[model samples]
Target: MDRYEGFREFVHGRQQALMRSAYLLTGDASQAEDLLQTVLMRTARHWHRLAGDGNPEAYVRRALINEHVSWRRRLRRRPETPTAHPPDRGRDRGDESLHRLALQEALMRLTPRQRAVLVLRYYEDRSVEETAALLGCSAGTVKSQTSHALGRLRVLAPELADLLNAVDPQEVPR
Candidate 1:
């Protein structure tokens, strides 16, 4: 078997999902592309070792989260100020699109860790223990962060408060 065949298969099968996670992490399509590309390159380099591990998806996910957090830290150290105004997005498609945009903007305002927690727990449908494991934090930390993040989101995007409150109570940590 070709040594890289497994890596190729993995990328082919998972790129879209990985890209979605990257987009959620960076909140920009271009940045998400760059982030996914960088992580994929690194994963390719270590594919031999990673393939033997039963959970390459988890490894790649942890890498994505770590790289995103690192990028945020680096960005803080060397922030850029855009002089030009962003191009207008034109009329909202409808109430749903507007709500989605509001939620996304509110997500951008969250700390990277909080955003990561929310993405993993809610978006990815991971359990609190799984999120903690992926994040290298205690389960209690995941629970608290998830609680705090949802609270902050409620504050940041009051318009979505009803939708946020609609999350299944069973899914949220007490």
Candidate 2:
């Protein structure tokens, strides 16, 4: 087998899924592409070992999450100022797309850690323990972060209130 055959196949099969996670984590398409590329490059260096371990996807997922957090920290140290004008939403997208855009905006406003918890718990459908494990935090911390993140999301995008209810009625604070 070609030395890169396995790695190539793995990337082809999982790239889309990983990209979706990347986009969710970074909240920007270009940033997500960059994040995924950086993680994949790192993963490629360890592909032989990771492939033998039989769970490269998990490794890549963890790396993606960690790299995202690192990028957030570095950006915080030298944050860019936003323009006075918000980017136009571009014509009427109707309610569903508008809500999605609103949710994405609110998510971007959250702390990287909080956003990671929400993505793992809600988007990835991971359990509390799983999220905690991925986040290197206790289950209680995961639960609390989830609650706080949800509450913050409500404040950041009140229009998403009803959609948030659909996410987990018990979790969204009044």
Give all TM-scores, in the order shown.
Answer: 0.93, 0.88
For candidate 2, write residues 30-105 as lDDT tens digits. Answer: 9999999999999998887898888888889889999999998898899798999988757458898888889998
List the lowest-lDDT window of 10 residues for candidate 2: 165-174
RMSD of 1: 1.7
lDDT of 2 at 153: 94
- For candidate 1, what is the lDDT? 0.91
Query: Poorest 10 consecutive residues of model 1 by lDDT?
Result: 165-174
Clashing pairs in 1: none
lDDT of each: 0.91, 0.89
Q: What alpha-carbon RMSD in Å does predicted model 2 have with respect to the real structure?
A: 2.5
- Evaluated against the true structure, the overall lDDT of model 2 is 0.89
Maximum-lDDT candidate: 1
